[model samples]
Target: MTKFVVVEGRTLKQAMKIISAIVERYNTIPILSHAKITHRAEGLRITGTDLDIEAHIDLDVVDGGGGDWSVCIGVQALAGIARAAGVMDVRIERADNAMEARISVGDGAAFYELQILPEDDFPEIGGKQGDLIEMFTNGMLTATLDKVSGSISTEETRYYLNGVCWHITKQDRRFVATDGHRLSLCTYTPEGGEPASRIIPRKTVKIISNHLANQNLKIYDVDTGKLDIVAPGITIRTKLIDGTYPDYSRVLPSRHDFTLDLKRDEIIAAIDQATATGGQRGAAIKFSNQNGRAVIERRSGDFGNAKVKTSTPWPAGKVEPQPFAFNSRYLRDVAAGCQGAIEMRMTEPGAPFSIFDEDKTMTRVLMPMRA
Candidate 1:
């Protein structure tokens, strides 16, 4: 029962690129490095996973003959072969119940072979996807993630912040991520779904963002701490992070008496210019009203000091804002995705404040550095 998968080299190459996102870079398990190529009546499906997430993409068939059996081949190696194959047809075949598999490229012009792992050995994250719990367009999903993912913490100690917390209620759909110092939250409207929540890992959010640019429709299956996304001929299933998201709303400031509206570009440019001389840890950014004009300043030991002026108008009768220092690293995180006029609001120099656009669909809260 020799099973085979024949697809165009270009198509295989494209599919491998998507599967590549799920392949774990550091894996001790031999089978984890290989992609399980399964032959079906419809076409060839290539699958890869890193235990936490499983991704698969289907390719158009060129020519193949055999029963539906799967063979695991090294993912990166196969991708390299596909890239070299060019416009040729890629033919992959294995003998029935055999360990060795052969890859035919360019009609016998070049051949590559490797000992394959059994399909049963390739682990898959499974879930019962009965319905599309939530339906969102590519742009919507990308916008939501981009607006919030920057705040996703990389610290392993507080594992809860290592991913974006998605909460779906009968009335609202929101995505929130925080790295302790700063927090970002975005709200969006989806087609429909039952009340559910999931902490999608940062790795999986990255994969979704990469594919969202080209995908038209994105389907989500969030149930029992699992998330399965189906898009076109691609499917990605990932285990949700098992942790309780902190009540972030409590820390978010409700109102700020002082406010400054600065253009999005100026905010980003100020952070970029100021943080250039900072060290690996973080740098302090100082903001204050200099003679009724808004000013940003950053001082580094050897690099000297940098300053930027913004068009934010100060209230004529209000008390001038005292010099306040904020971590440039946190500002950079939220400033990366901000758009339009960013309203900087705070009750005082030491209190937590928020920055957001006019519509307020997304908001970022940052705590200022102590004096």
Candidate 2:
């Protein structure tokens, strides 16, 4: 229990801000509000969990003299201590009996004594795992989730849709989210893995998107409905939603009877301008197919009527598509997510419509509303 950790005060402060975010502000279990601190020759590792998700961050140490040790202390309080210390180096040492720890700055210029919880009481997701699967670059996983995050369902009744659904299609990984009104699907290449699917909770999706950047992660599917993510100095274990993800492929329109291509920025701007003059929330915008080359979106309000045009000819020899109406908010969100040009496919106004990006890695399905 003689091991101690020394780190720059400013560096400790920044690292604590990130790790403590994983610890809940309040919990009935005291240990759940604390972070597990482990120190070895290489550096210090700080970890926190909310039972469902566990994450850790590693910090380089200024001195590693007294061997290896582990302890648990209040995360929020530690961050406050570091902030108060300013640029001075901070040292942390555990009591001989291991029942408490002291965080000191500037040779006792400032110090705080905090009670320690049993390290073994801390919870982590651990179980028998199948073979670790192929690699997923941070850019791919984060970008895919960011695009679909807006469409993820927040309704409590059907809880499965509350997170992004990850699965394999043609050996490529696909992430999908929907709120029943609209669906967004993002595809990435995970290299190698047995075919499987899991619904990631919304909170976990946000945490991973924010912190796990620029590193390639290895994945493992555990037998207990949990997933493991491992990178060089980070490890995150998360529980998958226990429900089955809906079969979204059924909602995808089979044929591209008619396709209209437009610049991504142009369509989003048109959607925004047309809906600006609307009265209340949840306003619907109507898209009228005019001539063979143009479609007009117009919204009528008490002040005046607003009209904007997305002019692109229907593909040659295909039946002219009928005018369709959609929830303005949903359409604008899906359109804004496109990284490139928007290619829209439709059968009829009353039927399901599909939107594709120029690279074809992303797909969106929107249901039309009665105009």
Candidate 3:
């Protein structure tokens, strides 16, 4: 008997959006590029995985009573078909041979046939093997990832550093990422009790951010190399990076000689203007305090030089101005992470400086670059 399902195009699109981040465009294992669709009594479950990370979402469908059938179809093809569907409802039916599936828009307005792989060939990506850690709102998880994700190292050689370090200290829950030259740390209070620490891979971090952007979520089986994230109608199983994260506490500065506060928007505008002059191989921007004003300047041989100055609040002391140079891109990253005013605490010209949010929950450390 042929299996078939009638579903709403909008519903399919929503499920695809949640799983698409985990779908790999190209994979040695052909089924890895496809999403497994299973019909259940409750609803239709759509799942995508790349071996290391798996994401699934349960969607309500117009039950055709397909009698519990599972099949794998190309994610891109399925998404494309859904997007092109002109009507609200789309009908999907498997061929008599069970090797292909046909999708048709309302009353044959549009038709598409997609090849399918055997459901038995699909890999099973399991959930957490440990214990439930804690439950937190989706907003909290999203906010924490946004603050530290920018500093995640892209260098594969330092595999452990390629993800965000999630741990709980005596004071608060911490999310940290670093690329040797710069580090970002975001902290929040734990809900109930502390959870075990884990190094979340960059890919998994991105997937969680996309899926749980604004929902409540629960963490399970943390620190066991696998994590289970449970949210409304969705669950994500991701493998943590199997390595130890660096001791980030040693890098945070204990003291600074001067603190300069600049308007977040104004400093970001200045940095944007100054960095635009940077050519293909962009140069560093010089940050210096002039009297009671902050100035940012950058010069590129291929392009031209630019300078922007903004008034800043300086402490009431004989403040000695020191010039500090930093990568334009790094400075911009820190600036973008801040909400209100940007605070910079520096010890000397070449030493690392700290940038923090107004509430000080998020802190970024940046090493100086020679100008």
TM-score of each: 0.92, 0.86, 0.92
Instruction: Look at candidate 2 and tell me the lDDT of residue 69.
Output: 78
Clashes of 1: 0
What is the TM-score of candidate 1?
Answer: 0.92
TM-score of 3: 0.92
Judged by TM-score relative to the true structure, which candidate is superior, 1 or 2? 1
Q: Return the top candidate by lDDT.
A: 3
Clashing pairs in 2: none
Q: Rank the candidates by lDDT, best first.
A: 3, 1, 2
Clashes, model 3:
2
Q: How does candidate 2 fare on TM-score?
A: 0.86
Q: What residue runs in model 1 are displaced by over 4 Å at the alpha carbon?
A: 190-194, 218-223, 275-281, 315-318
Least accurate stretch of 10 residues (summed lDDT) in model 1? 214-223
Residue range 137-243, candidate 2, lDDT tens digits? 75666776787888899999999999999887656788899989999887766453567788989988887777776668777777778887777767777889989
- Against the hidden true structure, what lDDT does model 1 obtain? 0.81
Per-residue C-alpha lDDT of model 1 across residues 1-371, encoded as one tens digit per residue: 45677889998988888777889766799899999998888888899999998888888898877867778899888989999999999889886656888998976999987887877888887667766666666467866787788889999999989999998777778999998889888877643347766799999899888875656555666557777777788888888899899988898998778787777777788778766676645678888776677778887776788887767676444576677888887776666677666787888667888888765678789888952
Q: What is each predicted model's overall lDDT from 0 to 1?
A: 0.81, 0.80, 0.81
Stretches of candidate 3 off by over 4 Å are 127-130, 190-195, 280-282, 289-292, 313-321
